[model samples]
Target: MPVTVSIAEFFSSLHVSGQVGVTREALLPGDSEQTQALLSRAFQDACDDLPGGLKADLECCHAAATAAIHYLYRVCQALVDRAMSEEQVAAICAAMPPLPTSPGEMFSQDLALRHLPELWSMARSMSDSDPLVTGIEQAALRFPLSSVGIALKNSPDLLSLRRHDGLWRLYIDRIIARQDALRLEDASTALAVADALGEHAHSLAPKLAARLALASAPALSAPSILSLHP
Candidate 1:
């Protein structure tokens, strides 16, 4: 029998913080205009506290959402094939290119478009392993969900992009506690996605950053190997 995996199951495995129960809204597909629009509006609502007159364009928002979905699938697929080290994950995270600062720059910029080939080449080099894929398939049986909604919740990877210079560092810190699960690469995936989405993702970036800070705060205080060492 063939094994199957749902987005929710894959997503749940990404965090060792414990599953929050994936929501229907989080699983919405990103390819369609309607879905992208919906995502854009949802992000806009999430970031309403920002300055007035900032609007999210469809193209930019769609790109952002696509990037998130793309990286999420790619990294999980990679994990399903081979176990990755913290350094390997960090290397992948480093592949994410920074976005142009303003919305106009994002829309007009070809830098992201130019970098697609390099990303594809990097992914191709990773290839697939049957045993790991099978394992992931078997694990997916316990967390199945219909494909009607989107896969990720709050686009945690993209959400982290709103933070200061500490995004990857913070993830590294959290992963010390969560290890093999919570990864700097995943945060980079989110950052790249939001960076692709440009102004569209920016509105929600601040809120996302704040939420991450709160969630990771306790992990610092909890007893861990890092604290024991120094």
Candidate 2:
């Protein structure tokens, strides 16, 4: 029978032997593949949505994909080792591609940075005080569209969903579906997302209604309830 080695041992062997004898199964974890696939799909969708279905800037896209893969690898390594210092976090952030200023750029950057929020959430659960967690929070703030699920203490003043091309609707929907109050900063944010959904996201309306009701019941502001009507 063949031998099986732990991920740590596999990496250790690479360091000692300077050979890549391990299989993809031994190297890329399942979640890594899933994340990669999601990025691929996002890329395809973005391309399809382009005018005349033309391709995007290949060089920019390649850089985004490379950055994402590198970031994911570093994060996984840190998590596995159960140790990530502030300096390491800072290095990772510095290596990230510049913040996207356009919708197209946002879609491309999101291919990898989208995972930051969930990774940050995981890190927070491990240690709320960890520099890794705080670093991720700051990183997430710069990518609000991709970080909609993350709750920031200082929420940005994004009053219009149109600014993000309504891309954040999906993340908000997921938050609402899970009944995650913390993910939404406050009632105002939730109401804004709900209003943006309008009739387009009918399925989420009831859930949104319930969430808003529960959130605003203490204050029960008439204006907040009326905004949900029309």
| All-Cα superposition RMSD per candidate | 16.3, 10.2
Output the lDDT of residue 35, model 2: 48
* Candidate maximizing lDDT: 2
For candidate 2, the lDDT comes to 0.55
Q: Which digits, one per residue and each the tens of the lDDT, describe model 1 over residues 1-230?
A: 43444433433343224222322222434236554454455444423422343334312444543444444444343443346655554444443323434342332222112223233334444543333233322222211110001122222323322332232232233223222222223555334333433554325444444434444456556556644554
Off by over 4 Å in 1: 1-31, 51-60, 72-82, 104-230
lDDT scores for all predictions? 0.34, 0.55
Question: Which regions in candidate 2 have their CA more than 4 angstroms from the true location?
Answer: 1-42, 46-60, 157-161, 164-168, 171-175, 178-189, 196-211, 214-230
